[model samples]
Target: MTFKELIEQRAQEKNLLFVPMAHRFQEGKQVYRLGHVMLYLDRNVIFVFNGKTWVPTSLQSLLDMAG
Candidate 1:
């Protein structure tokens, strides 16, 4: 799903599992677990929580993997 769609789903769903992933990214930065989404300060990579676990991937890598 798209980012907007994902966000909407997250907002609507109250039972979605959320887990924290605090780590380094572009100096002193950490990742946040908001429902099913993981938002970061830097654009280097994205870590999405895929139900069972977290999916750590870059934008290009995700697109490449989809193809």
Candidate 2:
């Protein structure tokens, strides 16, 4: 599976939300619910929302936390 698809699958397994960076904002508000994650394909990285900013994070780090 593709990286994006893998992320989506893992996120689902962990019950965490996954969203594309493009849809980050909607109606002037963040589209992702608080405590969710955003995928930035351009940078080929993932970021987690810390209630303020999108913080860069690694997939392994997230998986470690999930387990």
Badly placed stretches (over 4 Å) of model 2 are: 15-41, 63-67
lDDT of 1 by residue, 1-67 (tens): 7653453355446444434365634235565555435544334446554556556666444333323
lDDT of each: 0.48, 0.55
Q: Where does model 1 exceed 4 Å of error?
A: 1-29, 33-36, 41-43, 57-67
Provide TM-scores for the models: 0.26, 0.46
Candidate 1 lDDT? 0.48
- Rate residue 2 of model 1 by lDDT: 62
Superposed on all Cα atoms, the candidates' RMSDs to the truth, in angstroms, are 8.3, 5.2
Q: List the residue pairs that clash in candidate 2.
A: none
